[model samples]
Target: MLIDILTQRCNAQRLMIAEAYQSMYGRDLIGDLKEKLSDHFKDVMVGLMYSPPSYDAHELWHAMKGAGTEENCLIDILASRTNAEIFQMQEAYCLQYGSNLQEDIYSETSGHFRDTLMNLVQNIYKGKPVLILQGIREEGYTDPAMAAQDAMVLWEACQRKTGEHKTMLQMILCNKSYQQLWLVFQEFQNISGQDIVDAINECYDGYFQELLVAIVLCVRDKPAYFAYRLYSAIHDFGFHNKTVIRILIARSEIDLMNIRKRYKERYGKSLFHDIKNFASGHYEKALLAICAGDAEDY
Candidate 1:
């Protein structure tokens, strides 16, 4: 019943349910579920209780909390989200934690990688919503000249003096629309004869390059990139339950079907199959439920 309710309801509906549950019982749904349930099942249920932005902000806090940072969590969220989404997540972060998300990120991270994340998340701080939110999708205007120019700038960053590389790359990646960025990536390949991901791998190391690679992969094919992330999360012969739960829940409404298709294409097996093989019990059942309605194996 829990699985059915969470899996069947839209996020808004689920939030209503959580609210109703709280009002009726005088207890928080997530808190009760945490007390009753254990392990990943609790995680899935609790995650379902929050709205998407709250959940994202929650993930971000956890990513930056404690002894060390989970750089992948930061990269996965900040790199892939649209500017509008980031803005909402930032607001939610502030509301939930009573601290500025950007400041926390700045204090937690350092150097070029920190700078890149700040750039990606800077739109909200500027007191204006980005163009993407104001219906850029229906128009999606891509300028080839601009793309080529941006491509040259990126090439210079890779080939030229070391000091300016991060600025050049993050400026374009953080600001461009996905359509324009795609064109820029094509121009980059034409000028450099190397994939941008490959170039980043060559030119930078540590989390700086990792963030760039994630952005490039996300720009080119988000579902494919997510599929790879899902694979990477579980295929290490160890259960990365946090990453798997995060991706499955976060992308459930957004693009799970497309991600499922890409996963099969890339791995020669269904995501359902992989989950069954790699995870078990109600934890697996919860994942499979969000992933329900389509599990046809290739």
Candidate 2:
């Protein structure tokens, strides 16, 4: 069956099969699958068909399309992705939707959240001398004095009593390298007697607060941030399986291993245990496969 084959085939093999299916039947494979399948099975199959960038763009579209914005989706895609990944998604968004990703995000979001998203989508990162495929850096802070200065700049940006200069905050968070910002965060805590995240929470409200917190957490510990996101996605009011699938699939090759370890350490249970509890059927099988294996105890 198509469903069975889809669940079993690798992405490349699936792409080939999709091509063959369309050639043979003169119908798009996803269209045919949608016609035949229902519910989550259909969802997973369709999700699998998209090349990664297209998949990222499609997720962004769905996140912004409805009445309410899915801020978690926005943060996950915008906050956690590498510079090259974001660049690819922006291109894919324009190509697929015939609109600029940045312009669409600006229209959908407002204030500091929008500011942060706009800067993040630009995919600008600095201080890397070597050419990397995805523009992810392996470098750390190079100047202590610069870090301290940036730290004070960040503290002043958020610590204002009358008005929080969110532009300055966004500039520091968006433009600074993660390694540089990590030092800045540590220095900010020393200077302000509060963590930058705590400062953001106290000074700001709504999606802006959430976006800044996500950025700070991402800089501090990426795997930990994702682990927490996965837990929240599954444990929230209604099951957020879409988030679970998106995060799992997107991070599978990148840092799922680290995420799994951090999730287990933080949540007192393995990600595999949680996934099994929350998901099932062929869809669950596909997720578990991407996860590589179950928990050590499981």
Candidate 3:
């Protein structure tokens, strides 16, 4: 049905696709998206599909093949999507694969990347609203003075040469709610007269710092940073494949439209043009579809 919808140029095709899927399958069209698409199209469709976690291990297996591991694609797909989508994807993955997506990723990837992605996937798939509420309450409820001291301790640990603090920071950034962390970030800035993210950057390096920066920049001003990422990945960084895939796959559904606008404003050229110049094959097609702002089509 999504393929049929995409074949036509009707303005109502997206709604038609949605209605057709819901009526026929008793499920959302995102599942169909997984079945019907590949490369950047799959990425964009997954973004717009928005079912309660409807992507399965088979679809994930296919997407993660070729030049990248399914593990990495799973992390990118799950991390970029909303929590509701993640939960639904987890359910679908477990049902179809006979194993949890989280468990599969844990087994497949290793080190801090694996750990950070697992923590994020777990939080999203947990189906617990109170976890977020509890995190928000943590510093305020358990003695403010003690909470402040503990936060300082955490910060100090982050500054140490050993990686334990870095691990803790990754866990915090990956697992904590952005809303909750926003408040904590504000408090940290108030105390130190500098952004907590800036402090983290000063203290860390390599992939650890990259992940930290991704989270902080995402939280601070996602669109602008994405614009910068797109620009840097294509022009400054000489079309780094992983970076290009990561930014495009991550933003296609949520903020590609904004990123496109920013790209035009920043570079005096459309992002679509730059993407075309730098990328090819199915990946380029998918990115073009997303930049065109018609992601609902499969």
Among these predictions, the greatest TM-score belongs to 1
Could you give the C-alpha RMSD of every candidate to the true structure, in order shown?
Answer: 2.6, 3.7, 6.6
Ranking by lDDT: 1, 2, 3
Q: List, residue by residue over 1-298, the lDDT tens digit for candidate 1.
A: 8888887898999989888988998988888888999888899988887888999999999999867999999999988887668878988999999989989999999998999898887754246555444311212668999999999999999886376766888878877788898999999999989988888898888998899899889988999999999999989738788898999889998998999999989899898888899878888888888888562551
Per residue, candidate 2 scores C-alpha lDDT tens digits across 214-256 of 8889888899999999999889846688788888767766788
Would you estimate the TM-scores of all the predictions?
Answer: 0.93, 0.86, 0.63
Q: How far is candidate 1 from the true structure (C-alpha RMSD, Å)?
A: 2.6
lDDT of 2 at 84: 73
Model 3, span 1-298: residue lDDT tens: 4333342322245557778879988986767677877765566555444332443344564554345564434534544444555566666777766777766666666777776766666643345553441221123122345435545645765668466766766665665556656665666666777777678778766544566667666666678777877788789878866556556544555677788888788788888788779887766665565456433322
Clashing pairs in 1: none
List candidate 3 stretches off by more than 4 Å.
1-79, 123-154, 161-164, 236-253, 265-268, 279-289, 293-298
Error of 3 at 153 (Å): 4.2
